[model samples]
Target chain A: MKKHILTGTLTALLTLGGLSVPALAGPEDVVVENAWSRASIGMNRPGAAYMTISNTGDEPVTLIGLATPLAMMPEIHETKTNAEGVSSMSPAGEIVIAPGESIALEPGGLHAMLMRLQEPMTEGDTFPLTLLFDDGGEVTVEVPILSIAARGPED
Target chain B: MQRRAILGYGAAGAGAVALMLFVGWWQVDGPGGPEPIGQRPVALTAMDFRLTDHEGNVVGPETLIGRPTMAFFGFTYCPDVCPTTLSDISGWLDDLGDEADEMNVVFITVDPERDTVETMAEYVGYFHPAIRGWTGPEEQIARVADGFRATYVRVPTESGDYTMNHTASVFLFAASGRFVTMIDYHEPREFAVPKIRRALEEETEGAT
Candidate 1:
């Protein structure tokens, strides 16, 4: 009974406080670089996060999940534009990263879609994000918020 | 004998239809066919329609005329395309150097349900300083969309959430509010910058 109560309290606090998860633990094969998100305009607005994901491991790995406390829901999505210049977004599932290959989650392409934003991603703010791998390994890291108009870090 | 006669008539009818179609196509093609995408301005002159700008001012097509304009249709909820296209426009404006002052870019929301005037202001605030966002009642927005031949719809997802899928092209207009051409979404800086320069020149030429 005591354990259940403690866990419940912790979950509630995490959700209410918008607590970012603790830093990633040891032994991560996937290196996440330059994880950043553009500042959202208002509360409850949607936002996007981008980063470069590199696979240093010898074997291939597939990304299966993502989580963030800043958003009520997080999803992996990709935007595609046709020849006629119409754009559509679709859920991207199981993105496989080949060994020695790097995949970019950038603007106008694959991205982490943050829905029902719980907090404003203001400039100079930072948040925690967790990525789950199909092999049961997870990477938790800090995403430094950038200006809303930023096209890249240089901007 | 009757079957043979019927067959002959059918062949004659088919020949007649084929000749008519060839003549019709020759008339429509007009020598070298229709003009290229970036050349002729189609005069897509937008009809006057009321809309609330990000600055809370009531505006219409007439309010935006007399300047080289680029009309873009999108929503704030768009994650990748909208921001990317906005960034793309910013780059073109940057390349335009001092001439950028003579151009106007308008962002009209197709998802007015969520994109209020306040939100529209906040969203466009991220792009180039010259870009402005507009939003209004659904019927008014629909009229403007019809004027530009743009399309957008709220698409429902499997998870019960929704997204706004919209035309991603940037509609270019001359100083006279005549439709010039378009810079398709994700168009390379090299392709868009030249066309923009020419359009600005056209605006200047028309002015003097």
Candidate 2:
């Protein structure tokens, strides 16, 4: 009778352990946070998007593409200055997020340009965006629309 | 009787000639000469160049003609100096009331990399919507700066970032797009306003 009790206890413990495996798996390996865009001005105005990308996986991830409902095309850009005192902006091939590291996209630096808006983006509106990673994974986030003067100091 | 009349006429003519000579001598010695101001008037003329505006519009020296223009060079990310100068100019314009309508204020962004036409349009609107901002292809911008004798250099920082050191003078252009004078960043209002006023008056006088 004692040997039969030991076998039943082992079987119960194994079943309980199997049920908790999903909990240990947690969520996705790559996370995107604080995704936002500078608000658009008028119907003809263009807007820019900014965000922070954090990678939790052991392998490095590359951001190969981006998309937004507001823009016809989304592109990653960097500002470059030449010796002749002119400023120009060009496309960045890819943004790499190393394992256990975060990359920040901010003003006056690397940022995503939301080109050719379908409609005007007004203040207090939120736009949906999706970012595509090189590993065939994607994340969706909402970008808050703000006034053009939002980031500037009060007059 | 005829001889006496002739002698009186001769005496009157001699007295009139002598009076004219005395008046001319006094006028030469009086306040008609130049003032005793220590320095001679320096001609503040500058050369012209072609550049592009925030709308990618081609603008040349001719754009400033027909109005008194105030031109300043600064960057969009400048934390203090650039904004303050622009704000002050806006306030000064407010004080000028109807006079401001005839003036044109321009802000040229020194940082071309970050100040695209779209960025400049947004940045310039923050100060005052009336103030026009100009940025161009790198070569064009450099040519304009060099023509104005403005100096700008980039210094690398420890973080691999860099800062630009540039001349901070605000240039004044006449109605004909000729350089009239310059107001240093630290020029007092007592000095600057009067000079600007004089330039305006001169422009008006020329027009009339």
Candidate 3:
């Protein structure tokens, strides 16, 4: 009787383990690469984040939203230069990436405007950025903060 | 015939009024508009200015006018635009070689509240050795920006914080203190090198 009871309990434990593994949601097929941002100056100062988003799979993806714990609000902003070379910055909605392609968000183009820092960002410090996609994919990327005038991570 | 004459006079009077309005608008709003980018469309009459540099010494038109000078208006907090432009300027100076000595690059802060003299000094040093940075009273900075016909507006964010939208063009002045031309905000070195070489050559030609 004792041997039979132990076998039944072992079977039940294996079944529960199989069920719990599927409960954890995995990140959808998307890759975020080379994320970096300039360090903010003070509490009320605004800093910018730049990165390259690649759609590695055959299916296209659209980036819908961005959130960060470091800033009060994070949104997509594009800097446009007119034919006369006058630049204007405004909020950009969503950006779509085709299959096997990537979109680079850099200066004078699409970028993430991190607004109103909760605290000063120091060099070498990093923060978490959650990128929301149309495929119900949420990818968290670690963006390392560089100096006040850092053009890129290599700098 | 009387009605025809009245109509003709009325049309001519209306045309005259339209022409007058366009001229008035162009003077304050068109040619000298808030943000004049690219090679300056017209030669801007240089205005004399008195302000301090990073060294705390008083610098004015009297001190700065004698050499070929380049003035850029931007804030320190500007990560991408300002640094990219400054880096490009550094490249221009590097391309100038010894001709660089004849030209001076100065960075003036549009956001004076944060871009103190110390800030400007540190920021400018990152690019090139000869670059100078300046900041002063808000009115003084405005006067200098106005003198160049540049525009900079404060843009408020969602959290009541603000960022600056400033004129990113680089202004070039001749040794005569007259506006020579503006190197479009981010003109490549190939495009900028020739224009700057010609300007430097002209200074030499004028001196001889």
| Interface Cα RMSD, each model | 2.7, 10.6, 2.8
> TM-score of candidate 1 restricted to chain B?
0.77
DockQ for every model comes to: 0.42, 0.02, 0.28
- Candidates' C-alpha lDDT: 0.78, 0.63, 0.72
For model 3 the local lDDT of residue A130 reads 73
Error (Å) of candidate 1 at residue A54 is 1.5
Model 2, position A115: C-alpha lDDT score: 64
A127-152, model 3: which lDDT tens digit per residue? Answer: 76777787676666667777665656
DockQ for candidate 1, C-alpha atoms: 0.42
Ranking by lDDT: 1, 3, 2
> For residue A38, what is the lDDT in candidate 2?
49
Per-residue lDDT of candidate 2, residues A1-106 (tens digit) = 4542443344334333432111111126656555555455454444676767678889888888778878876777654433432233456778888899987665
Report the Cα lDDT for candidate 1.
0.78
Using TM-score as the measure, which candidate wins?
1
Per-model fnat list: 0.70, 0.02, 0.35
Worst 10 residues of 2 chain B by lDDT: B36-45
Shift in Å, residue B64, candidate 2: 0.9
After superposing candidate 3, which stretches have Cα over 4 Å from the reference?
A1-28, A42-44, A124-126, B1-45, B94-99
- Backbone clash pairs for candidate 2 read A86-B138, A87-B112, A87-B113
Q: Which sequence of candidate numbers ranks them by TM-score, best first?
A: 1, 3, 2
- Regions of candidate 1 where Cα sits further than 4 Å from its true position: A1-28, B1-48, B158-160
